[model samples]
Structure formats: C-alpha cells, structure tokens
Target chain A: MKKLYGVPGGEVLELDYPAVADYLVQFLRRELAWRGFEKGLVAVSGGVDSATTLALAARALGPENVRALALPHAESSPESLADARLAAEAFGVPFEVIDITEMVEGYARLRPDMTPHRKGNVKARARMIVLFDLSVAYHALPLGTGNKTERLFGYFTWHGDDAPPINPLGDLYKTQVWGLAGELGVPEKIVQKPPTADLIPGQTDEEDLGLSYARADVILEHYLKGYPDRYVEGLGFSPAEIRRVKELVNKTHYKRHLPTVAVLSSTAINEFYLRPLDFRIELE
Target chain B: MVRHAIVQLAPEKGQIRRNLARLEAALAELAEDRPQVVVLPEAFPTGYFLQGGVRELALTAGELEEALTALYRRVWEGPLDLVIGFYEKDEREGAYYNAAAYFELGGRGLVHLHRKVFLPTYGVFDEERYLSRGGTVAAFDTRFGRAAILICEDFWHSITSTIAALDGAEVIYVPSASPARGFFGPRPANVERWRELAKSVAAEHGLYVVLASLVGSEAGKGMSGGSLVASPEGRLLAEAPVFEEAALVLDLDLDRLPPVRYDNPMLADLKSGLPLLLNDLKRVVEAL
Candidate 1:
C-alpha cells in the first residue's frame, strides 16, 4: 500500500541519478585500474540488478571489454533469457547464454528428494563456477549484481551470488537499482518485470519476502537510521512485516562476511590487519 | 588587491613522493600568475583514510619543507606564502598528528602548524583511531594580516573559528578532504553543505573564509573538489568544480572586513561574554 518511489517522510531515497552515474562510472574505472584490470565480467539474469551492473561496466570500461552472459537453468523462463540478451544488446555489449541445467542435475541425482530450494542453490552455485572460470579465462574481474536491500535482507544465496570480487550495485538498494536501471537505458521489458530468482514457475521476489521492494526499502532505511519499531509502525508498516525484515537481516548476518577467523596473532587477516591500500608503497 | 588561490588536489593514497611532486608542479606554475597566497586541500601528501598507515607515511615538518624547497628553488620565488596540509610525525615526542602548516616561502619559513582538534570517529570517518588530537587554535601574523589555518574536522566546531577571530585573525583557511556522500540533486549534498558552512562562518565572524577541498577516488570513496572563497559578507566569490582537480583564484579587498564587522558586530558582542563562557567551559571540563 505504500508509494512506489519515496519514503513516507520525504524524498529520502531520491538520488541525483546523473551525478551518481558519474560517480559510479568513475568508481568502477578507478577501482579496476587500481587492481590492474582493464575489463569487467557480469552474469546477467533478466533482473534489474545485473542489467544495471552490466550497463555500468560497459559504460565504464567500454562495451568491447565488458562480457555479459546469461547462465540459466532448464526451469528458467524463456522470457528471462530473452530479457537478459535484450539488456546486453541495449548497451552494445556482447552476450552469451550458458545452460546450467546439466551441471545442477548432477547434484540432484545424489539426493533424489532434494527440495526445490536445494536445487536452486546448486544452480546458483553452478552459475558462480561458470562465471569465475570464465573470468579467469578472459582475464576480466567478475562484477557482483546484488543490491543493498537484498544484501541487508539476506535474500541472496551465500557464496554463490555474493562471490564476485567487485560490486557496483552492492551499496544501492533494490528500489534505487530500479531507478538506476531506468537511467542506464535498460530495456523497459526488463526493468518493469517482476523481480524473481527464476527457480520456480510464477515465483516473484515479493511473494517470498512478503513485502514489496518499495515498502521494504523505506522500512530498512528508517531501521538503519536507528528508528524504533514504534516509529516505523507509525509510517504505515505493520508489526509483522517489520519483524520479518529484522529477523532476516539478523539471522543471515553470517552470509555477508568472510569466514570468521579465530584471533591467534597480532595481525589476523581481517581482524587486526589493515587494508592493503593503507600500506601500499609511497613512491607511486 | 591581495590575490590568493586554492588548489583542489587529488592526492593519491600512500604516495607522498608523487603527491609532493604534483604540489611542486602546481606551485611552480602558480608563481607565474603571482598570487601572494596559495592554499591546498588537506592531506596533500597522503590520503585522508590512512588508519594504521599514518605512522609509516608521516613526515617531519623540516623534511616536507626540504622536499618542497628543493623542487621550488629552481622554478620561481617571490612574496608567496603556501598553506598546505600533511600527516605530521614528531620523532622526539613519538607522536603523530593530522596537521596543517602555513609556510612563508618568500620570507620566514614554517610560520604555524595547526594540528586537528576534532578527529571524527563516526559515520565513514575514522580519524580519531589513527591521529593524535591537537590542542591549540591560534592565529599567526602574515604579510597580509593575522591569519589562521584549520584542518577538516576542526572547522566543524564553531569554537575553532571563535578562537581564531578573538585572536585578531582576519582570514581563516579551511583545508578539508571530505568524502562525497548523500546525493539528492544535480550535485552531491556535500556541495551544498560545504557552501552553507563557509558562508555561515564568513558572515558570523566578519572574516574571509577560503575552503580548499580534495578530489579523487580512493577505493571508491570519492572526495568532491568544490574548493571556494567567500567574502566577509558571506558571498561566494568563486568555487572550483566538484570531483575534478582544479584551482580557484580571487582578489580580495581587505577594506571590506571592517565594514562587515561594524555592521554586524557579533564578535563585538561576544567580547563581553568571554568571562562567562570561560567559567561555564571550565565547569564542564572539570566535570568531564
């Protein structure tokens, strides 16, 4: 029942898409150059997040240097593949379609009664394998397509969807991705389509999350700003919806980070160790 | 007409030699046009996000001065004064500071070094974790007049300018290296926010305010370069473009300061309340 584009209080989620586009374009180019990379690789699903990431990569590193591939399972909708191609073509980037059905089925045989979710995880992980191997073969950095709202909600498959080394859309929320997708000239069919994992028939992201992205982003924004539950409830969200989002974020916190390490030394990898950028040579 | 320039530099992370080389090149070129004073953004030698890396990268005041003068003497020299920021480390004291130093290239060298007082530790800034907090905020004498230098976070507090203005400062140079964030319009929200702060500070103290900010992306966090100069009446004289390396120069009419102060008289009013404020501050400090 909430509005599609804005938070209840005001234009909290509103961004200057042009400025953000320029900043992100610069961010990609500089980050790529810092790590001695000249190209970017992205796994495009017919979804807005991947399309936006692909478009940004194409714009930042040129269409010829960016690689876009759709890794689809047998159950993935035909329109999803078509839309993925449409996204890559819209930006003049090269595209390919990889059938991950055989790879996912190999695991299904070991456990005949594997749930649909288990199969989905296998498919997602299979795509990650193809993406990383292709990245190594092509010498391109793999770009992650996960958005902030999904990351905070823990809606992505751990180690599968979150395995990429770089992400342009990881900081942007789902609703913001939709707005950016429109700005990047992604196809209307792709932008307007209901977001889904394409694992099961007629499955949409909202159906699983039990709340629309428009509503969830507003709630998440307020919640992150340290607003109490009572305050968010006053903004027209129900108690049950609030609790579900909170629980998902809390329960799936482990999925967001690298493996937790026991602190054994003064310079533990992620614990006490400083960022490499901090200790880089000063002669440059 | 006392002319000045602010260079919005994009100092690379952990690259002191390259950063110093860039500064040397800028100063060499700037001498031709001949601005009496020049200001550069904060952390002109190393980037602002150096956490534990500060210890390895910091330079002594004499060491930096030697580096610049070595490159500068070959190019040009005149009645030029340079105010630049650096990560300062004192070997004798075994201490490090985020400091801004004012150098009189044509006359007495190393005029003043103002260490940052407010090292912000909240929301994307982790300065307090790696830097030693500065204690004093005082104005020093220049050929133009009394001037003071304030590093990035120190300017966030009104007391820094209050101390400078009371110490008979006519101009305050704020060298900042803030990351651009919070987008809402054609520009980053920082563009608007910085202007508002500059104008308010200039008007409140009836003094000229020069804001020199950095530009570049370090690990994807961008420093929007919108360096600017404001008049005593809170009017923006010139602003450098955001997110690019550029310089803004202005000619100031020093005669404007007295009239602005005469009309507003806010500083004059505060002079009478100093004792009360000092007493209250003492009580607050004792309690803490």
Candidate 2:
C-alpha cells in the first residue's frame, strides 16, 4: 500500500507479521530481558486495534509478560471495559483497569467551559498519563494503539492517543485491525463493537465525525487510489462532509510531517536523504 | 533439523489467481525437498496493489481455507509449517484485514492468522484505507522455535520484535514483497541498513533473523532482492543473491545462543531500567 508522510504517493514495503515479530522478539529479549521489566504494557480500549496489539504483545512476550492497561473515563461505556478485559484474558495477558473518571472529572470541573475538542484532548492526554505511569512502574515500553485510519484523518490527539515510547501497530488501518484481531484470537465482542472514542457519553466516533468509518474509509481508499476529486463527488457524499474531510486533509497535512524550518544554509537534512532520493528519481 | 524457506514473491500485474497458483506450484516443488517451514510475502495472492480493487482481490479467511489448508496437507512429506500473506475478509465481522495465514503439516490446520499492524503513511504505501489495523502482538508456536508473524510495516516499530523476544522466540522470520528500486550504488550496501536494523534488533535480543524479499517488479516498482539469514551475533549466515530470485538454505545452531540473558551482562543492566538521566535530558531538549 502507498503511504503519504509529506511525500505524495510513497509506496510502503510489506512484511509478514509473524516473521517480523519473531525477529523483533529476539531483539527485545536480548536488549531488555535484563532490564528488569517483567512484562510489556499496552493501553487497550476493547477495540480490535488495541486488542490486536495486546495479542501481539502477549504472543511475542508471553501472556505473563504482556499487560493491558485500560484507562476508561466516566463517559466510557461499561462494555468497553468488558471488551478490554475479554481481549486481555483471552490472550492470557494480565489486565489492569485504571478508571480515569476522577481525572477527567477533575479537569472538566477545573475548566467547565472546555470545548469538546479541548475536552477530547484532555481525555486522551489523561489516558496517556495513566499508561505512561503504568509503563514506568512496570518497566515496559509504552505501546501505542493508534492505527492508520485515525492517523490518516488526524483523528487522534497528539501526545495523547498518539503518544507512545514505541508503536507496533501504527502502520495498520481501522479495517485491518479487525483482520488481525481475529487471527490473534481477539474476542468477537470487541471486534464487532462500533469504533468509538468513548471520551464522552453518548458519543460514537461516526456520530461525532458526521461520517461512517466505512464511508470515510471508502473515500480514503479511493483518494489513495488516485481518483480525481470530481470522481469522488459522484459517490454521493454530502458536499459538506467532503469539504470538511478535504479541509481536514489540507489543514492536517502538517501533522504528517516533521516541522519544516527555513533553510538557513545550503544543506538541510531530511528523511529523503536517508537513502539518496536521487536513486529514487525516475530516469528520463 | 527441517530446512525452511520464506519466499518474497511479487507477481506480474493483475494476475492474482495465476500468481497464487504459481506460488503454490513453487512451494510444492520445494516441499519435495522436505523443508519443514515456509513463509510468503504480504499480499502475495492479490499482489500488493496499495490502491483500489484490492478489496475485490482480497481473500476471506474461509475462501483461503480450501486453497491454503489443502496445500499444506497435500505438500507435507514430514513435519512442516507454513505462513502465507493474503487479503482476508471476515464475513462474520463484516471487515477486511491485511492477513497472514498459518498451516501445519499433516493436516494440523489453521495455526494462526495475523494482520499487518503498522501501516506506513510516509511513502508510496497508502495502507490506511486498504486494510484495517490489527491489535494483537504474540508469537505463533513453531517447531523451529517460538515463532511469531508481522507484516510489512510491523517491523519498522520496535515493539513487535521486543515483545516477541520476551515471549520466547529463538528465531524471527520476515517475509517481504518490497518493490525494488534501482540504484547506482553498491546495492548490498544499501540493503545493509535494513540488515543492520534487523541484526541489531536480533543481536540485542539474542535471536536469529531470517528475511525473504520479493524478486522482480510488481506493478511499476522494482524490488531490490537479497534475502538473508543472520546469526544471533548479527552475522550473515546465508544470503540469496540481490535483485534476483534464489533460495538459500543455512544451518542455524539455536544452541549457540547465550541460553539465558545471564551471558549478556548488558541485558541485565538494560532490564534494570533506562536511565532516568535520559528522560531528564529529553525534557531539557524539548523545553528548548
């Protein structure tokens, strides 16, 4: 599949996950076995994506070696917690429930007028705080749970949902999450649950965004397929939704990049140079 | 010991069933030699389209059951396990995932299926829309060792490997259908970076790394092919020729590994904890 990280239409190399995980396991064990970490820690929200990550962690490190930290806010559904536990236990990993209701409440009460965006940001950040704390206490790397779908739309709070010491599942999309989750033995309840932020009560991700993930994903799929904008409009999406998403794509373009600085000198380094881009330049 | 091969095969444009058939034939031919384990590259069945029509080309877990399961059962001369890349639809769940399926010899059947976790967003790969993200991290049990699977972007992140190590994998195999890019430089030198990363990840974790890269062009991009097996010490034990198709077999002494982290004092120290000093340093730099 092609990825856009500032560069337009860059192709990504594909690897087999088990083989990659096998190699990765050896690397981590040799590097961190003596580091006193008894386990690996990840924040799972009962969603297929996180559940998949948790399963990977457990399988790669062993159930005992993997731990799930569920940081739920007051508005988060009870089923979300149940799903998280179901996934963790199914994978044979340890589970920890850290209700962030108090923290979210404290922040909300402290700032009653906080905008939804700001409140969402707080909820995400609060969850991360708990996750990081758990990681430190456990001496585990904080595994990130954001997927390609969320990352593509800039749907996550930076340093909040996106923050992690290391992310194993960052390259996958929302749809793929379900695929791997089933293979990894994730419970059906979590996989079937409609995608949600669970930041506020009565909020489904689609309702908040004014588009179904399926539709948004189809749009994204077509956009990546190199369809022109006019062709996209023929698909019967509301102009407003298209405009909002397109505006999002434009405005959030910067989110996909390292901050650009005015070149003060002749040579400015970029990931482009990691392997001479000249080689990648098509010969005339 | 059972010799194994993970071929990173990229097919000619728009030939899904044919390519898969060719793969099955090639694998069956190899099976005649009695290799115990085999792995194939990502999206090998439909090819890595990275764009539209992938959903149509993608295979569901059930659809794959007949082909892959039968292949494993039919090809087995001895104890063998196989992992292959395919696009899988979960009809029950009503979702599609970039999936890898595992089959064991003697008709053991459906060992595991894993989805690609890390979807790259920074390059010619736009996997975000084509596939859903997976949430689990674990190893598939293998006779060779406690093995695990990861697809495409999963290796870029360190977590997948690290967790695999702690879980008890002695060897890590990676199957890749990386589109080749022609370069003027020493191609091996170019591949050395990935080798270094893989070796470092392996050596630090003290496990063997086996990589299989796709040969030939797929769609428009060319692959830089050089599949190699590395030792726990990060030394190349055997390697397939670059930018071409070849199968390499090498003996690995799992016994040679340090046995426990005890042999590597660095491991113990690392486990003690990352220095608080580093966090402080990072904070200071961020403040600026």
DockQ of each: 0.55, 0.01
lDDT, candidate 1, A86-192, per-residue tens? 88999988998889988988788989899988888888899999999999898999999999998998888889999987788888999999888888898888889
- Model 2, residue B175: C-alpha shift (Å): 2.0
Question: What's the TM-score of each model vs. the native?
Answer: 0.93, 0.47
Candidate 1 displacement at residue B93 in angstroms: 2.5
Candidate 2 displacement at residue A99 in angstroms: 82
Quick one: best TM-score, which candidate?
1
lDDT of 2 at A209: 67
- Displacement of residue B199 (Cα, Å) in model 1 is 0.3
Candidate 1: pairs in clash:
none
lDDT of 1 by residue, B49-99 (tens): 777888888999989877766766766666568888899998998999999
Candidate 1 chain B weakest ten by summed lDDT: B71-80
